[model samples]
Target chain A: MSDNAAPIQLFAKKARVYPKRVWGTFRKLKWASMVVLLGIYYLAPFLRWDRGPHAPDQAILIDMPARRAYFFFIEIWPQEVYYLTGILILAAVALFFVTSLFGRVWCGYACPQTVWTDLFVWVERIVQGDRVKRMRLAEARWGFEKIWKMALTHSLWLVIGLLTGGAWVFYFNDAPTLLEQIIHFDVPWGVMSWVLALTFSTYLMAGFAREQVCMYMCPYSRFQSAMFDKDTLIIGYDEKRGEPRGKYKKGDSWDDRGHCIDCTACVQVCPTGIDIREGLQMECIACGLCVDACDGIMDKLGLPRGLIRYDTTHNQEAREAGLKERSHLMRPRTVYYTAIITLVGAVMLFGLMNRAPVELHVLYDRNPLFVKLSDGRIRNGYDVKILNKAHEDKVYSLSVKGLENVEIRVQGAGEIKADQLHVYADSVGHFRVFVVADKPADARENVDFRLEEVGGANAADYDGVFMSGKP
Target chain B: MSKNNEIDKVSGVETTGHTWDGIKELNNPAPRWWLIVFYITVIWSIGYWVVYPAWPTLSGDGERGGTQGTMGWTQYDQLKEQQAEIRARKSAYLERFENASFAEIRSDEELYAFAVAGGAAAFKDNCATCHGTGGAGSAGYPNLNDDDWLWGGDVESIHETIRVGIRSPHEETRLSEMPPFGDMLSGEEIADVADHVLALSGRAEDSEAGAQVFADNCASCHGDNGLGDSALGAPNLADAIWFYGSEKGDIMSQVRKPKHGVMPTWEARLDANTIRQLAIYVHSLGGGEE
Candidate 1:
């Protein structure tokens, strides 16, 4: 012990925050982003795209049982999962690009936590009243007025949470059909459980957790400084001009005094309730409502606006040093991130454009590698599987090469009428093909088989081995 | 130990009677809810020990090994219950398959689906040994999922073949024999006929010379284009599917000393309903004909 200190306190009770509502440029931007993002989330599942009678028609769907993912006109089979990885990489690099230029702008404006919490707070304000009234009501004794307002506010929040959860399940199933099934209580128990879980989490996150999710739960907020640079824009106070804060008088001399009036308007309007004059803090969401509050007071006082503003640290330092503003946006980090994002996007687009419409897989019989007929001919059996990715049935003609005098026999696929094989649309056709060669050179030889569409340009080939070894 | 009971400077909490390098630990109590969760887990573990098979017995008897819980829960018992539930669920399909006629079953899509599912299970359990897992038959056995059946390829014929078996000891087995041709024809004659059969499938270089030999020695059972008669259980030598093999040496050996394979009568081993299921399953393997 130092012998001059008091006993330690391990815990401190949380001070309830009642941020006074304010409007500005950032507030309008945030409101616009929330509307656009939430609108897309709730309505995208209902958007329909006409896939033929054999496939789902949803514009964006994850058809689990069919093992297919449909995005508008593009259908992705199970084998095409790498496209999702490409998308994730693109999104991550794009986020890095945006963050390097704008700092925690995404966290303040478009994060789901911020948007849902804003909606919940707005609902609470409508049911109750403004900040002072809400604070008073919280401290007041239980009454019918308080009880009704609290109940109404919570019920509205729950309704929003329910809709949020309900919209999520529609992406996995046909939206209109699932809605009908859900209303009639015919939905599966597993689907119902997912809906309930999502509903509870949304309600808990938006209603009561509020800013705690951004501060304590979200990992992005913890590592946000890594993306920030001296030139990156952030919400900051002009300490050089506004410091030595004090209340102003009408006949003040304007000598040996800073411009700040110390009205605490900026602190009062802060969503995370941190004093901006204390420099930047991790809890500050940089939403810029404080800037609007300060600007309003400055206008009233006949002073220049922007006592709090969105500005870069380097620009602020240069201005204080009486130098012209200069920005360095073409940094090495941003250039590399941009290049990687472009490369990934281009590669994925190229892959999607070049994907073949037909695929061939050959499974040579493992047991009895080859059979010998009385005619001195060696035979090998193969399960030739042809996947027709087209939307309509296709007739494919089969041919074998790389071995002379090879006879192809497909069981039940009678006579090689031009060596044709019929495969249904969007399905795999399996044929037991027996390749016979009279007096095969050596015990085994590499052979190539091709399945060419009877009248179309699409074709696929597989290299297989013709075994003439003992059975 | 000298500064163990002293208070920490900054936190304003009492020391925890411990110190490490002049940094005193705080005597802070855990959150009440956290302690409640801890107590709950302690109680849950005791309850679990009482309800489930937990401890070994002192007796060390090999049979009555462990202490049985009050609930009498065992992993084997759980498995049996799960299996029983699955069987109960499938009983509806079984009842329909048992009562419906083969024609009736085939006409109803739902009944056919049930039969196919039940038949697939039976096929894997009983028929997968001889017939490859997918009915892609081995060298000696005929591939059931092909159109190259010796007797016939129709569903009815398949049912009869499965019930009576081929060359089985059963009284009504489908019996046939191609008397070893080596006794009558020379080895060179057999080789020539083999080439003629290969030429029918377009595998041989020439069939002009062997065509005369084939007609003279093999036309009675093997029809005119080397397409054998299915009515008498003779395979179509014109096709590429060779039961024994397709090699020249294999054919010469078979002509010299024909080794006929026998299939046991399934009716004697399996129930009639199961045999019916096997027939439907075999018929559904894609190569079954009308």
Candidate 2:
């Protein structure tokens, strides 16, 4: 719009950031979430589940060796991979639910990047002083004191990293035992290596990479626009109200300009250091620290609050035009997100309820589908697979029915004195059984294979085409 | 860190200065000690990756992925170490349980204490699923460690129950199956016979017309006394130990429907020594019928 053709665009000069601390409701929420989420991650592994004597006692463990995953009361085996799928769906929809309701709440508060960076910043404040001092220290001449500052800060960061790494491996095994093992310098190689790798990454990401992860590497940051709309409550600066901004003395009245004193305190406290007055940028985490800072400034200046606040474009425009609209939280997109979240949750619960403890699989012996004995009886062979899904073994008998006048024969199964064999718990057992179809040698396609536990008749049936030259 | 380029060192590690969000570029070198530690760990991990079963394939060519390191270290070896530790502890318990006479061990002061500690843990792991923790009885699963036993509760019988287990196909395993009364009698006739059978156990909800059918057909295994035969694995009808259930409907269902419980063969799954130990362990649980 600037009609000065001779003027070439000069890229905005970068300013070194030193965000001063600000506290308010959003900050408190962020703090509480950080504590709770981080607490669960670090402490969960130390909790114990007495799964009798046989199973590992570490609750919420991911037992890689045994291929078991335990979460409190729920134990999932590798075979129950659908549970993992359900979990992934639950995670996705749950995110949608959270996003729709609070609007970027996860990004502002619960995102690992936000939480860990908060922690690292706290540690940095404790060791090297606040943002101002840290900035000054970095800019200070290379002296022994500066060296000490860097060493102290980096050391603290690495300690947090080490703790993070240590906590991560605990999820895989008994945390207390692993900790002891690590201290003794005899942790399992796989575990130790993973801990080392995780520690290094945590240190680098939280300490050095910092906000760059969300800015450059995070996929969520790149595509969050697709999920956003004008109605969504975003960290917004009311330009109509704050524009014509100019410096105001402590109590001086200015009727010509807006309430904004242009103190730029909001900019100074912003974690991303982006001026919200420029409109919603992809970089804004919507942390509301700016809102808190601006509110503090407006209160001191005796002006109406909300220089920067959670608001919408539509609401801002309506307010300016003197016709207000009620805030809409139940938009179609939010409704869709909630419905999807509930649907996925219901499906997961249903799946958990209907899970079977015992199952069966039958493989037909295809090499010789059927054989004709000299006695003129036809025999169909089958490889019956029995799965004992229970924690205990099963003694199930192999029997046949659904075909008129058929005698069941099992090759390895001792004389028909009994029909059952012992199947191990959490394992599959295969038996080669021969069914003497009493039908003529010309019979075909009409038979059922029944596996019944002798005396204990929890029977399973498999229907196979009884072949005899296709009838 | 840039792909396919070595650091010239003259122009040091300068970051690309594009700050967005609060993330800014820092012009600094990776800590020398940090990089050294990183390299060492990476090299060590690669060495481990090259030597272990790190990858899986459907073709069963898993060995092709690893170098088969000089020490031949494997997950199996680690598992073996754990197993060895377990075995060491187990041997102590097994020696005391299997070697000591039940009465002698049961009566002794210290020996009983040790057996209780070891047996409690073992039962929790193995027997608790079916036998119930602390030998508490469920419908189908029996109450071990109780005086009530169908076969015999003597040391030998107890050992036998534990060795082969009831209704198992462990070669010398205990075995039995109730004949399908459905095949033997018409549905109506079976109900009559069921009533008669229930009557023997003082649980008659019907007439005595079908008592002859029981005396004629069922007495062979159930005994003329209706107390049941141990050799035939016939359940004692007189006692309250109903294998399926103890209710009138349950008893009638058994008479008409019949209840047959199966015990898996312990032979292939458990080692001979372990089976011996388990037998003694079950015997100590009390239902080792003499």
Regions more than 4 Å wrong, model 1: A1-16, A50-57, A140-145, A179-188, A368-385, A407-445, B1-120, B127-161, B165-169, B173-264, B276-290
Best by lDDT, which number?
A: 1
lDDT per residue (tens digit) for residues B1-290 in model 1: 44546665777666877769976678889999999999999999988788887898898786657877778898989999999999898787888878988777777767776777778898889778888787878889788755677888777888899999989989999998888988988877888877877788888875665788878877888888878887888888877688898888888788777889888888888888888878887876645677
Best by TM-score: 1
> Where does model 2 exceed 4 Å of error?
A1-18, A49-58, A366-382, A402-405, A409-418, A425-427, A430-471, B1-290
How much lDDT does each candidate structure score? Answer: 0.82, 0.70
- Please give the lDDT score at residue B215 for candidate 2: 78
Candidate 2 C-alpha error for residue A259, in Å: 2.7
For this target, which candidate reaches the highest DockQ against the unseen true structure?
1
